[model samples]
Target: MIRVEEAIAIVEANSTKMPVKQISVSKALGYVLAEKVISPINMPPFRQSAMDGYAFKHSIRHQYDIVGVSQAGDHSNIKLKTTEAIRIFTGAFVPDNADTVVMQEHVMANKESILIAAMPEKNTNVRPKGEQIAKGEVVFEANTLITPAAIGFLASLGIMTIAVYKKPKSAILVTGNELVKPGQKLKKGKIFESNSVMLQAGLQTFGLEKTKVYRVKDNLKATKKALESILNKFDIVLISGGISVGDYDFVKEALLQNDVKELFYKINQKPGKPMFFGSKNETLVFALPGNPASSLTNFYIYVAPAIKNKMGFAEIHKPKLVRKLNADIQNTTGKTLFLKAKYDETNVTVLDGQSSAMLNTFAVANSLLIVPQEIEEYKKDELVTLLPID
Candidate 1:
């Protein structure tokens, strides 16, 4: 058994970031960059007009001769003289001598000349070269998550591919004899199996959808065989159920026999006291308690961080904030308790039915109130620590 903090530290120390791969910028969405990106050229490459109007050197004069038309993609070297302007459209490169642009609506045009409604500020309606990003500049640092705006920015600089951490592949092994698949008839002493589906949804939250779910009966030979078959096939293996000290519990023995080194067997927390963490080479193995709520909670606190760290998340820990308790709490000794709770901006209220097997309260919980192991009681309106749930 170990404290929650120690358990977290152990998981983090063993979870290393996954190897990097080169992928197209278009396909790199939601992936963390494994290397910095340097801009190969200036974002705009040249000074450009920002509006449909005339480009000319700034002047206080009211009229100017319209020398030529400059649309986008025009790269001609037509120079502008004083009292002369070019009919330019938006995104058109500014002529060599042009320093400003007056919008078409702001000027009245004649056949060969236009009257400026007023003397405008210098450099108005013009996007200067390298204004957004300079050539050879480091645009994004390593570990930065690629977003849609980032993709657009990189595309503007002509970036075709990027280096990013690969998402972890996962496998789930469910062990039990008294379980039945959902949508099937409920036989005696059997309940619907749900941990695999629930965990699949959780893994998808981190963009890890290439997960395989396998089932094993409670027999030791079957459990060992199942663990051995996929022990090296995934970056993470979640074994739900058969971890407690029951006659049918063979997960620990099977993991050890299959070269999975046990890092820890338990955590000093309510509902998840029987959790297990182990490793074989680079693959992480977690033997979660069979109770649905406990399995999910342990996964969120322990297993999720491992996956996230391997995926290059900057912060792999969940945040805990202090909020005033909306009601009193009767605490128990010898274990750190996690009670499903609802919290507003200023207050947190513990929900009812906090047993390890009941997930109803967790369904409506926005946070988990943390009750330290040594604490015995808490009064109303007391300050409490809470971890927000995603």
Candidate 2:
């Protein structure tokens, strides 16, 4: 069996970003930029008023006559001279001769002449041309995820459309004869199916908006039929359960029967050692464990990053923070473990229940306490890597 890091390296080596496509700025959110976005023109293209006030020459300190009124989107060029001011609203273009703006509250206006109570400062209340962004400047770089802020910034630069990487289509399959739908009556020894829903939600956090899920029974024929039907339709297939050594576990057998090339099966990790990975034609497949916690952990630590890479995201991994353990932790000598933990600004406490079959503990966990296989006992206050839960 390979180590978890080694397996991740293999997955990364095989993954590639999807093709780029042109999309409107509205639909570009969460998609990776395929090309650099350069400003076609200066932001605020011309000098405009940053406040609702009077536009006048800063050199004139005395009261001036109100020559004309300027509102936003008005194109009339009304230049100001000494002892002359123009009534201007916010965002209106400043005339060529005006060098400053005096707030309306600071001036007493009449029909013809306005009383200036305070002197205007040079360049005050003025939004200079290209102050926010310069023409031909790169506003966004390639491989960046287009967030809400990015979209707003691009739109401010008068960009209506952008080129972004296409999102990958993924199919999720959960296989187990003993598994039953959530609303169905449970039989003896049967368990409710939850891995499919959990995996789907997890994938969405990585910006996967489109996902298809299927439930296949624990049989070679049924599994093989399902794989064959969806082989070419999805970029990746996530299968849960029936990958272990038990006689009823037929997922590995079904993949082989369907000519799915096995990449690697099993890894040196707790609760996920029975995991399997393969490929049939161009579709990548992962046969995850049956336990809910195991499935989620495997997806986060491995599958999620692979899918993000395929979606053109440059940084595929989640953020990790260094935390100090509040109590001592003991584990086996071999196989890495991801223990559910809760942490705050001061300390991190590992949950008492660390079993792969337990779901309640994982529910309250804010982070995963990662323990290496070589360490047997972690002393209190020892610094460890904490992977945050999405």
Candidate 3:
């Protein structure tokens, strides 16, 4: 067993980056860029009108000749002489020699001639070339996750494909013979198999939807067989249950027998003390506790970070904030406790149902109050560190 920080350090030290692949920029959302993306050319390419108006050199003119019109995508290579105005619309290229634009709302048109009731200042309503981004500017740094806005920006830069860290494919193994699929009638000691579904849904949030499920009976040979088969296929494997020192707990032994190096077997934490982490070459494995709440909590704390690391994310953990506790608290156990907490934007109150089996309170709780292992008691209104359930 080790401290929570030490466990995280071990995972971070061993987690390796996945291979990079080039794909369409539109399909790279939620993926980290493997290389810096630079603008290939100046945005707008030429001076453009930023408003529906007339483009002209500001010369204190109240009326000018409406020589020609310029609209978006028009290749009219028009130029304006002094005191000349051209009808223009938003996003249209401004003619050469035009340094300002007066909105149509402030002008009155009479036939082919127009009158400027008010003139904008010089260079007003004109989007200068390269104003948004220079040709050589680095718009996205390596390791930056591509977002929707990033897709648009990359498209504007004429980038069709981008190099991004490949998403890690994972396998989920839920072990136990006392489990049955949902919608099936319970037979004696059988309970609904939720860990596999829960894990798959959890992994999907990270855009890791390419997950396969395999259930095994609580037998050494069955567990070993599942481990050997999955370790050869997936970059990551998540096994729920059968890690504790129980009569039917065969996952730990099965993992060890298949040459999966045991990095850490346990942590100094509650709800998930039997959390197991191991690896073989580039494959990372997490043996989460069986209980639903414990499995989800451990998944957030450990498995999420591992996936982020593999995806080349720079930050693994969510930001922690300190909030005042609404009630007094005490902990005598020699292990850290991640108490389900309800943060009502003002103060944080620890929820009642904190047992590993209960997800009722866990669902309502928006944060986890971090109570140190050595701390005995805390008075009401005291500040406590917590991580939001985002």
The candidate that achieves the highest TM-score relative to the unseen native structure: 3
The 10 consecutive residues of candidate 2 with the worst lDDT sum are 276-285
Clashing pairs in 2: none
**Candidate 2's error at 335, in angstroms?**
1.4
lDDT of 3 by residue, 1-390 (tens): 899889889998888889999999989889999999999999978889999989888886788888899999986767787767899999998887888998999999975778888777899999999999989999899999899999999998899999999999899999988899999999998888888988898899889977999989999998998899999999999999999999999999999999999999999999899988999989999999999889988888888888999999988788988888998998988788899998866789999999998888988888889888888888999989998885
lDDT of each: 0.90, 0.86, 0.90
- Each candidate structure's TM-score, on Cα atoms with residue i matched to residue i, is 0.94, 0.95, 0.97
**lDDT of model 2, residue 202:** 84
Clash tally for model 1 = 0
Candidates in descending TM-score order: 3, 2, 1
- Is 2 or 3 the stronger prediction by TM-score? 3
Candidate 3's C-alpha runs over 4 A off are none
Question: For model 1, what is the error of residue 172's alpha carbon versus the real structure, in angstroms, after optimal superposition?
Answer: 0.5
Candidate 1 is scored at a TM of: 0.94
- What TM-score does model 3 achieve against the real structure? 0.97
The residue-level lDDT of candidate 3 at 237 comes to 95
